[model samples]
Target: MNEVLVSEKLVVRVPCAVIEYNGKVLAGQRSAALSFPLKWEFPGGKAEKNESDEDALYREIKEELDVDIEIIQKLPVTSKDQGWREIILVPFICRLKTLQITLTEHEQILWLGPEELSSLDWTEADLNVIENYYEYLSVKK
Candidate 1:
């Protein structure tokens, strides 16, 4: 895992995932109860202590989406200062190993192609990372 500290307000290190299936990438709509509520984002969560990025991502996906993923490639890590807290978001290219659609935190899920990527109302941090991802990752179709 890549670690960086800008201030004492560091909040968490999140391992975000980009799961590609068929020709589209997976996105989830966050529940309105959470921060940045109702915005779209790549599925992932905070990394636990002593866990590698890959391991944290795998565990997060299984817990959040109820699916197993195989990490194909790890992309760059982006850091953001959210006033009271700072976040280090790490993104990855991954393949889904299960087809089940399960969610405990998100309201819904969508599989969108590259052309439809920018049309969603994504969280600022997610959109920033998505921009970086689009430079190298393309929709399969």
Candidate 2:
């Protein structure tokens, strides 16, 4: 017989930003070296030690895309159970201060509308965020 273990863990607050321009949201394709490589996700990263969520968002956007963002709204937390590692993502609705995006951590990037989101192969963590955003948009309309 094989023994199995199950553990419950507290959720982490990882800040994410939804950058939209001309009615399309920005999504980056993770590098092949990453765990979920080639998957599309919003341009943001984990909150640094001793950094506020807002500060983390600003730094992440600037480092990853080389663009400044003005946070418009603090969106809800997007959670996902990844079996091994769980995640709690805080997504913010933001506007880009510049049009150019320089990919530093990602392999490629896409600016997609709501319809395009469903078609892309997103990471499990990102899929939850996408679904929640879709529901949010539906409710707003």
The candidate scoring highest on TM-score is 1
For model 2, the stretches where C-alpha displacement exceeds 4 angstroms are 1-12
Residue-wise C-alpha lDDT for candidate 2, range 26-137, written one tens digit per residue: 8888899997878888878888789899999999999998999999887778788766666878888899998788889999988898789878888777787887788778
**Candidate closest to the true structure, highest lDDT:** 1
Per-residue error for 115 in candidate 2, Å, reads: 1.1
Q: What tens-digit string does per-residue lDDT give for candidate 1 at 76-139?
A: 7888888878888999988988989689889999999967989999988888888877876654
**Residue range with the least summed lDDT across 10 consecutive positions in model 2:** 5-14
Each candidate: what lDDT?
0.88, 0.84
TM-score of each: 0.89, 0.86
Candidates' RMSD to native: 5.9, 3.4
Could you give me the TM-score of model 2 versus the true structure? 0.86
lDDT: worst 10-residue window of model 1: 132-141
**What's the CA error at residue 119 for candidate 1, in Å?**
0.6
**What is the C-alpha RMSD, rounded to one decimal, of candidate 1?**
5.9
